[model samples]
Target chain A: MLPIATIVFREFLEIALIISLVMAATQGLQGRIKIIMLGLGIGFLGAAIIAFFTDTLAASVEGTGQDIFNAGVLFVAVGFLSWTVIWMKHHAKHLSQRIHKVGSEIVAGETSIWVLVTIVALASLREGAEIVLFTYGMMASGQVTWSDVFTGASLGAVGGTVVGVLLYLGLLRAARRHLFAVTSWLLVLLTAGMAAHGASYLIAAGVLPDLVPQMWNTSHLISGESLMGEILGVLIGYTPHPSGMEVLFYVTVVVLIALLMYRPWHSKAVVAQK
Target chain B: MRFSFPMLSLSLLLGMMTLAPMAGAEEPTYTLEIKDHTFSPETLTVPADTPWTLIIKNHDKTPEEFESTELSREKIIPGGGQVRIKMGALKTGTYPFMGEFNPDKAKGQVIVK
Candidate 1:
């Protein structure tokens, strides 16, 4: 039962962190909660379907299907997140000045809301499927009773959600005035992390090379299996020993997003005009 | 501003294409099997500083995730299914892996020497 709880907790925590970040980031937007909830619903449904098709998915693409599928999901999430971060940069000024007006306009405009939904959905889909598959395996194996599974799952779910809530509240309190800037930057890092994660999957699938295998090892200081490692991994793409390809993907996304957001070229052109 | 979206996607495509697949078919291959949630040949020995392919076959009636933090590789093997994971060249050491669904019962190690 304890093992079951631990596994569920680890998976749930990853999903919870992503959802909480999105929720906190879009705090001022009207109907954002409903949109996020809708995404969760869709994600749960998708997870069940994916879990059911595990065997087929595993066998596809000459047995590299699972890695390819995971990479696809991560890349899709990265795309949505990058779009949202850049979009927010353009509208944040209006969002701060007239919260109510811009909030409604954001929902009514539909693009940002859909992007939010897609991000939330993709975040939940991968982790949620893992949880579903794990619990189902436990039940099917008959090594654990139904009550044990239920109790453990509930405990894990509650524990993960409480942490997510704390994170959301903390972000709100800490960055009230600079909420947009803080969250946007956070999203940028999160997007980069997702890209690196996707690249890792591609490397695993043999679709890409690792370039150099182990850049450096910090597992002695912080094992990837440890709780701290997991949190930092999700939050900032911290890997104790990242592959060369993973580092490249992470750096590329960060540089790309930074360039797009700041647009140093625009400033240079303005200076030239002066 | 509008051009940025196209630029972003185009760059992504270009990046992917440039990093074309270079996984050699000549790399050494190893096999691991999972039965009753336990790894057969729980300790696999391989040459150090050499990349290899690990083919994991799960004969269980339920899915298992093959995870190795040291290797930085994780993949799910469905019931009665198998997966091929490309492992990087490693220095001499012991790298542990486990079936995440049954971590306590399904544990193994890779010894690179």
Candidate 2:
């Protein structure tokens, strides 16, 4: 039970951290917390359905369905998160300037909160489905009873959520006025890293090129599969040995988004209007 | 800008057609069977530092996800279905895999030595 708890906790931890981070980053939006919660509910439902259809889906595309499907999900998430970063870029100063007004609020661009919904949904779907599947497997094997599985899963879920809350509190403590700006920058990089990750899966499936395969091997120093590596991967896209193509994708996302956010033309004109 | 660069990279990949196709080169194969939610031969030993193919045959009535975080490989094996999984060359080590739907009993390891 404890072992299962540990494994399940790690899985839940990643999702929790991502959820809290995104939620915190979009702090000024009204009722986004509720929307995010709704997304989780929908995501879990989606996860179960997807898990049940794993067989049919896996058989597709010459047995590359799983990879392709996962890559698709990651890519969609990248799109959603990238949209948030860009939307936030147009409103950062507005949000900071209006931070002091507790009751009066001004959300620039008035972009749909659905972007956050989609991200939370994607994040929850993959991990939630995995946890359900893993727990089900353990129960079916009778190696552990249902009671043990339930106990472990509950503990792990709580432990992971607690960590997320802690991280959120830490970020919240960092000067309310600047928190939005700081985390939005983090969101942009995180989104880019996710794009690289999605492409890596496509490369593994032979649908995309690995290019230089291993740009460098740092697995000996910090294996991405390790617990810490997994956390960093979620937080900052830290893969010890990213392929050349992933590096290309990462760099491209950063450069492109940065340009879009600060096109001298766009910035100068917008500042003049302000 | 995002659209342009991805398109540009797509062209770059397509231009390197020769290198891309080589990824599917023939490799050694090993077979594993899952019955009653348990894997046979609980451990499989293979030569290290060589790409290999895994032919998994699932004989149950429900589908199973064959997943391995260590090898970063995953594929679905439908009930009474067979699928091939390819892994990249690796350093000597043990990489465990399992039926994601029946992990507790369906676990197995690839011993690369």
Candidate 2 lDDT, tens digit per residue, A92-209? Answer: 5666567667444435433446667778889988887677666655565566888898899899989988988888888889747688777877777788888888777777666676
Chain A TM-score (model 2): 0.91
Best by TM-score: 1
Residue B74's lDDT within candidate 1 is 90
For candidate 2, the lDDT comes to: 0.73
Residue-level lDDT of model 1, residues B3-112, one tens digit each, is: 35435644664565345344548999999999999999899999999989899999999999999888888999998999888888889999999999988899999999
The C-alpha local distance difference test score for the whole of candidate 1 amounts to 0.83
Candidate 2: lDDT of A184? 78
Q: What does the TM-score come to for chain B in model 2?
A: 0.78
Model 2 misplaced regions, further than 4 Å: A96-111, A144-146, A174-178, B1-29, B34-52, B59-70, B74-83, B89-113
TM-score of chain A of 1: 0.92
